[model samples]
Target: MERYVLTVTLNAAVDVAYTVPGFSPGGIHVAAAVRRVAGGKGNNVARVLARLGVRVAATGFAGGAAGRFIQDELRRAGVVPEYVEVAGESRTCYAFTDPETGVVTELRERGPELGPEDVARFKARYDRLLAGAELVTISGSVPPGVEPEIYRYLIERARSCQVRVVLDSSGQPLREALVARPYVVKPNRAELAGWAGRPLETEADVLEAARRMRTAGPEWVLVSLGADGALLVGPDGAGAWRAVPPQVAALNPVGSGDSAVAGLACGLVRGLGPEELLRQAVACGTANARTAGVADVDPAEVERLARRVRVEPV
Candidate 1:
């Protein structure tokens, strides 16, 4: 039996995207097109991994009509859904895109609050799902009433099951989960700066911060720099590589980080080397940026971008 990669999104949402001729805040603008899809960081990652031909299962707390839409869309995208039902309606996120200027503005909702019963139920479901999972990726923020330590508990559980865990989160949850030592961690420049409690002003500063983080837990740390590309560091600072992606006109940068996380997770599961992994990760992110919508990347585009990516060891 093929072992599936499990993705966890504690706060799931229905993502609605609208394309307009141009965006003018506080002014009326007619939309050229509208689309709705399943969204959440992990859900986006699962979609990209599925596109890369990996078997994936997405699990999290969801409810109401929006939740149903999320599950249906995940199924349509070839990602198996195994969500736990909650009492409240799931949240909705709105993304407004300007095709002319390639600017996207998003209005995201804080998810519904979860109670003790909701947390307990989701934990029970997650434990059972771990039985068949080879790797687990936990992403996004936890809803209200959930402790920041929730990720720590889940990381410990995944370790007990002998499954690799990849974490992509920030702030308090990230601070707590670092103690559990996940296999990999993906944080953008801003997040890393927040964790370090100081602005990372240079490439050297970012690399140093990534090295400091590696000592706290995760075997690998990947720091994304948006158009500037990303920097990767391995366990104990034994290896380091930086990948600069090819410049392309970006359509929607909303879920590009999730796409990068998907690529890094894919490379890890396939046992790709550090350089190769960074290449693939950058390629996927670039492909995502070059296209519209979340995880709507083209495979051939990814392959072509991969060759154009410039990776250098630090």
Candidate 2:
């Protein structure tokens, strides 16, 4: 009776975040503070779920000492891992935040090299984990040479095992996963734009693009537009964007979407209706934006924002 959700991360990493005073390239400066956290799209989603009191089993590939640090960090955050060990060192993704300008610059690595045997082993572990999972969430980037259809592969397997699949990925993986069609897929602004082959400059554009993404494969789509809010499009057909409101005092935009995805998964687990889920998702996102470097979303804020989350027709 292990009731848990599985979060799969293919391009997992150790996230290092630091803030410095006003910064300019080649300027001598003193570092303000630095923190390292276990990170990956799926891992972050798991963290949000755990913070919300949901049981999660994170499954992903990890390598070397850095990978071990990632696993240890997840444990501290109450997210137990079912990690598959690999040969190379895990990659590190850094965030350089400047308080003066209120800007964050991201430097991402291509991630460690994953071999075919390593891939097979990861799949085997995934299959084992899926047997006991209520929901399977595939998130983050699919590394080079790992077929874009990997998302499709996982979704198909999850379907075969009668578990609902939740996907949060972008680029070709998003395109490929559409064929197998997971239960839920969350895409952000730029990601949705690429799927539509046009920029989503307006709310109407986001709604249309979400539907287009739906046609590609996922049963339900939640399109996220930072600061502005998020939209839900599905068989539930509840399309609405919860505006952040003009004067909410927004902060870091990072991890908000992942928090929203975690909210949707939690909602699905609770069998909530479309409107309730949408509101909760927005609450989680808005709360995350208010948090500093860490992705720990304030539960109290989610509740407060949930009441004001505006959902309008597309």
Worst 10 residues of 2 by lDDT: 238-247
Reference-based TM-score, model 1: 0.97
TM-scores of all predicted structures? 0.97, 0.95
Task: Write down the TM-score for model 2.
Answer: 0.95
Alpha-carbon lDDT, every model: 0.92, 0.83
Q: List ranges where model 1 is wrong by over 4 Å.
A: none
Q: Write the per-residue lDDT of candidate 1 for residues 1-314, one digit (tens) a residue.
A: 78899999999999899998868898999999898889999999999999998899999988899999999999999999999988888999999999898888899998888899989999999999999998999999988889999999999999999999999999999999999999999999999999999999999999999999988999999999999999999986479999999889888787899999999888888989999999999999999998877887788889999999999998
Task: For candidate 1, give the lDDT of residue 176.
Answer: 98
Please write out the lDDT profile of model 2 over residues 166-281, one tens digit for every residue: 88888888888889989988888899888789888887788888877787777888877777777888764444444442236666667888888888889999999877888788
